[model samples]
Target: MGETTTGLVPTTVRGEVEGQDLIMWEQLTDAARSGLTNAGFAAPIIDEAFMPNLESARPSF
Candidate 1:
């Protein structure tokens, strides 16, 4: 099964890190993303903190 949750990553993933706000996602600019893709990379690694709602997507135990 599959599901989708939509929101701005920066706002969605914001949290406290060392007592300060932390944004987990570092979305690349279009040029940079294209450059990476052209250079044979799929995409930049995303932090687990930025993972979409897996609890809802996963098959229930």
Candidate 2:
């Protein structure tokens, strides 16, 4: 509880100030997320991503 002109004003950091998960979730929605998190870029983060093995080549006749 904090002081105000007429009463005490209660405030919170969106979900919960102390919880890291909530903070991370909030961060995902924030302005910084425009550059930091890309849902389309997650393909490489997971194992077994599809990519052509450049080393292997067909013998050119």
Best by TM-score: 1
Candidate 1 lDDT over residue span 1-61, tens digit each: 2343442233234465234566433566778766655573333334442355555567877
| Local error of candidate 1 at residue 61 (angstroms) | 28
Candidate 2 segments exceeding 4 Å error: 1-23, 38-43, 46-61
Number of clashes found in candidate 1: 0
**What is the TM-score of candidate 2?**
0.19
TM-score of 1: 0.23
| Model 2 lDDT tens row, 1-61 | 6566654456665866453344564646566676554457533532343333332344557
Q: List the residue pairs that clash in candidate 1.
A: none
**Candidate 1 ranges with C-alpha deviation above 4 Å:** 1-26, 40-61
lDDT of 1 at 49: 25
